[model samples]
Target: MFEQIIAGIEGRIGGPARKVVVDRGVKPDNARHELGRHNPKVVIPLGREGIEMVAAGNPDVPVIAGAILHPSPSTARFHTTVTLNTDPLLLFGRLKSVAPATKRIIVIHDPNKSEGVIRAANDAAGQLGLDLTVIKVRDRRSAAWMYEAVFSSIDGSKDVVWLPTDTTTVDDTVILPLILEQSWKRSFPVISSTPSHMERGVLLALYPDYSKIGNALGSIAIDAVGGGARNGAVFSRQVQAAVNERTARHLGLKLSDDLRRQFDAVFPALAPLSR
Candidate 1:
């Protein structure tokens, strides 16, 4: 991803004097050697140690910014069921306003150990003064079991379903179709972390511009390399924000114009439903 972004920057610069050297990651020493093959004027380390070593080895050839690549925080938040519950008070509050009589919301965890989505959802609910029941599933079979269990526990009335951003759940080969099937049959909006999900038919999602993040990092890398700054100064941190719109409309939810205007990007152009 960084490589692609760097390529874009290079295209913009359009000069042979501006050479880019990507350090890749720490474990992949091959990336360093491969970069070396290109004979770049500077080397951009990816991590702390790599940056330090490169700085020490070539004091004159300043190390450019390092790359700190994690799943986009907003994207992470979208997958996070906890954030839905705790942090984004507006989202949960809206849900409450839309479904005033709603007593309990069911959160679905996609059986992935590393997923942070569940935590975000729980947090979002708490922020809205709402209560939720979380269900974890390991596979299609387990998902079915959990779904049934949730239905059984509810009062035979419709309930809101929350889906976390878990790779296992988003995998088209595995969970997406199943989720879409459930959504269509149940008429329940499935909240996810990626806009692609909303585009594909899931009710709603809140995601980040991962490609933009990559591009941002790439631009930073170019600056660091060109400016001859140390890696720590250039690439130690990042700024990220949320992007949601496609998800809201897909699920038939209305976003307030004020809130939509405040966002980095909004999907549908529907009128604001609330202040």
Candidate 2:
């Protein structure tokens, strides 16, 4: 995705070849020197850390950071080539179509980590005419207690446990297994972020395809060069969906063959028979 994004920009803005800096692998000063050598019109940083390094190194250059959370006066916009999606409306709409009975969703996360996501989800839920329960946890231990509180006697028919991207909470190896196990025990459905989790048992998943992300970033770069986006920070427009057919079957998430076809990809394709 990083290479693709850079290529897209280069292809569009032909001239001097752009210098690539791997701040993670190299020293910060080396990266600064490499970046500071030229006062390029646009500085594209590939990751969260890269964004910080570029900002420090070239304070004057307009930076299109790939993973920074918000926008500032100096910062034009986020690259959006690759990152966890913060919007819930899209997922909610997908859930409504696939699982028609789902009326409410419960999401657990640490407020400091994903407060904006929670707020956005809540607002979107209202617009979608759905109920959203947000469970805020401080850390792994708090997440454990909150999980029990939220999922106790959860109604699988009309309720879903949304496993948003939360490193402080759901990223734990032990906690992940426990969450999956408990949901399975209660016949509850879960929506996950990672492809691995979708393959494991999560009913639905969202990801940004590199090609699609590149196209969006290319447009952003073009727009930035023009004047500026009114909205400083923008969500990535390119999002892809994957479904775990096996999990759907397990959870009885009824969908016609045609509706299932709507997904960009489906996990657990029909297994080949033994010869």
In order, candidate lDDTs are 0.46, 0.68
Candidate 2 local distance difference test against the native = 0.68
TM-score of 1: 0.49
Clashing pairs for model 2 are none
Clash count for candidate 2 is 0
Off by over 4 Å in 1: 1-105, 110-112, 128-132, 151-159, 170-175, 215-275
Worst 10 residues of 2 by lDDT: 73-82
Q: Give the Å shift of residue 178 in candidate 2.
A: 1.3
Error of 1 at 245 (Å): 9.7
Q: How many residue pairs clash (N, CA or C atoms closer than 3 angstroms) in each of the candidate models, in the order given?
A: 30, 0
Expressed as tens digits, the lDDT of each residue in 132-168 for candidate 2 is: 9887778898888888887786899889998877787
lDDT of 1 by residue, 17-86 (tens): 3443434343344544545556665444433344433433443343343233222222221111111111
